[model samples]
Target: MAINIRNAVIQNVTGNSREELEDTIVDAVQSGEELMLPGLGVLFEIIWQNASENDKKEMLQRLAGGLAK
Candidate 1:
C-alpha cells in the first residue's frame, strides 16, 4: 500500500508556519515517534521520502550499531 504524500502532508490539522511544521517532524524523529503507516510498505516509502540514499545508509548503520547494545 502506498502512503499518499499529498494526504500525509496536507491532511493534517492547520499550523502557523512551515518552520513550525517542520519542527514538529524534527521533534518526531528525535522522540522516536512511530508512524502509523497503513502497512510496512508505506512505512518504508516514508523513510525513503524523508531520507536520501546516503542518509538512509548512514541511519541504518547507526541503527545497527545501536541495536548491538
Candidate 2:
C-alpha cells in the first residue's frame, strides 16, 4: 500500500490553533525520535512553499550558518 505520509501529517495537524501547532512542534522536537523527522520535514516543506523570496534567503542563510558552526 502506498501511504502519503506528508499529506497524512498535514491532515493530522489540520485545524490546529497557533498555540497548538507550536506545542506539537515543540513536543516532536523534544522527543528526539527518528520517526518525527519526516513530520518535521513536512512542516518545513509547508513553510518553504509559503515563504517569500527574502524569507527563503534568510532561512537558507540561517541554515548555512548553523551548518558552518
Which residues of candidate 2, in runs, are more than 4 Å off? Answer: none
User: How well does candidate 2 match the true structure in TM-score terms?
Assistant: 0.92
Q: Write the residue-wise lDDT of candidate 2 on 1-69 in tens digits.
A: 999999999999999999999998999999999999999999999999999999999999999999999
Local accuracy of candidate 1 as per-residue lDDT tens digits, 1-69: 986664565446245486875675556667664563332334355577899889999988998999999
Backbone clash count for every predicted candidate, in the order shown: 0, 0
Judging by lDDT against the true structure, name the best candidate.
Answer: 2
Residue 1, model 2: Cα distance from true site in angstroms: 2.3
Pairs with backbone N, CA or C atoms under 3 Å apart (clashes), candidate 2 = none
Compute the lDDT for candidate 2.
0.97
Global local distance difference test of model 1? 0.62
